[model samples]
Target: MKHPMPALLILLGLAIAPVAAQQVYSWTDANGTKHFSDMPPPPNTASAQRLNVRSGVTTTQAVEEPAAEGEPAAGSGPAMAAAAGYSDADIKRNCAAAQKNLERYEAAKPAEDEEAEVQTRYQEGLSKVQSQIKLFCG
Candidate 1:
């Protein structure tokens, strides 16, 4: 009979291959920029997400930080939107929509007769869309 040892070893290697894949860590910095690296974030980093590249799984751990003066606490604002039950795909879709709205508002030109009113409406819409972008994209 043919030896089974080599076949068993192959199966074991296949099982271990996924575990050997490198992990990717993602976090948004205070400047509202997203970063990804193989290394974990510094201690006390808030809203850090660990991604298993092989399994396509992501887990988030928010380490709360003290709020700066006049600012909301870390992970209390848009950063918590994911933890609020929205999936990453949802956030990405919303962020894209918000960005598109902002672009539309920026490209719009008002007739002279309605310039002031249009400007006011555009400003309001822009502000709202910007906030959404921040919440979803970050």
Candidate 2:
């Protein structure tokens, strides 16, 4: 009987090929939040670096400064959403959800006993939802 070792090795190599080809990026946003994702940051993001998945090596790429306050970064907006593998319909759905959350947060009233704690949680949730709105609706 023929040994199956070589065939198994070939199959293993094929299984690893896609993972080897995947890319990871690391960058700090304008708010100084460091992020790592398969998607590259916006073009105007500074200090962007590409990471090798297998070797854990990182290579820095030249990048421009972050966009001005209240302005979207280059390659951001809807295109960035697409690049992040989100379809138009997905973005729309998420945007609507975020809007609903924002409305709920705005209309909510905390109980008098736990008002401070509830208000803090509400503010945090609202900030996250608003950020999502900007990302999905822009």
Candidate 3:
């Protein structure tokens, strides 16, 4: 069984949805060009300004802070879930398992993309499985 391309994309997108805390550091350089970093820039002659990092940011790629010992943002899904009461090793293992489960759901797609029944079942299954994982894991 294989799902339609669009459905697969949706599944992957859902799998990857949800991000962590994001801080945007916007500062104008000596040349007046703005720059962003996960951390405050080192002492520079450039004009620097700090912007408040917001919570519950989703979509934007999260650049790890430079040695800030930061915790997982408020709602970072698997990353946040793994951070609580789990060692780095445990987090890696659980995260890998969660992803593998998602992939398995993806693999169980229907063969006929045009079949409404088949498509619905596959989508429903995928959605349910993903929701379960997030609820239990995250």
Candidate 4:
């Protein structure tokens, strides 16, 4: 009985091993001081961590204004900024092309009636247009 119990505990430990390894946090206060912690450190901390998993990591500075209105957000990567930035005229032109692609996709109407495929293609083209608009509008 003791042998089986120890084996079962070992298996349970192995199952939970991966999730126990990670931790993160981020916080900023009115005084412009920032704090990051895996867990509450002490009373002197900047603040307690936010509970959400997505924002758990305190990777970057928590600035007041986010990425300047219409500006490419920070950490979006140079490639994205380069790819997304377009002139006003370029955005309009790309948007026009995206619309044309959607129309063509709709008209193509496969024999199998695969609306999903057409929609996916149409959406991809539209996203390109949206990216251009986001950068250029800034």
Best by lDDT: 2
Q: List per-prediction Cα lDDT, in the order shown.
A: 0.77, 0.80, 0.64, 0.58
The candidate, 1 or 4, that scores higher on lDDT is 1
Stretches > 4 Å off in candidate 1:
1-78, 109-114
lDDT of 4: 0.58
Order the numbered candidates by lDDT, best leading. Answer: 2, 1, 3, 4
lDDT of 2 by residue, 27-85 (tens): 99888888989987899877898877665665464686888886556666655776799
Instruction: Give the 10-residue window scoring lowest on summed lDDT in candidate 3.
Output: 15-24
Task: Put down candidate 4 lDDT per residue, 1-138, tens digits, no spaces.
Answer: 757988999999997765554555566666766766566545655565744344254345456555766665655433244565755566556556656655675576455656788767766766765555444333
Q: What is the C-alpha RMSD of each candidate to the true structure, in Å?
A: 13.7, 13.6, 19.5, 9.2
How far residue 58's Cα lies from its native spot in candidate 4, in Å, is 12
lDDT of 3 at 83: 46
Per-residue lDDT of candidate 3, residues 1-138 (tens digit): 475998998988876553322454667777766678767776864666655554554343477553424544456554555545666676667666766778997787678746898798788878876775673355
**TM-score of each prediction:** 0.41, 0.43, 0.33, 0.37
By descending TM-score, how would the candidates be arranged?
A: 2, 1, 4, 3
What tens-digit string does per-residue lDDT give for candidate 1 at 1-138? 399999999999998876766678888888988888989997788979887775455546466777787544456534477768887678778888988988887788455678687778877888898888888775
Please identify model 2 stretches exceeding 4 Å from their true place: 1-74, 109-114
What value does the lDDT take at residue 60 in candidate 2? 62
- Candidate 3, residue 85: Cα displacement in angstroms equals 7.3
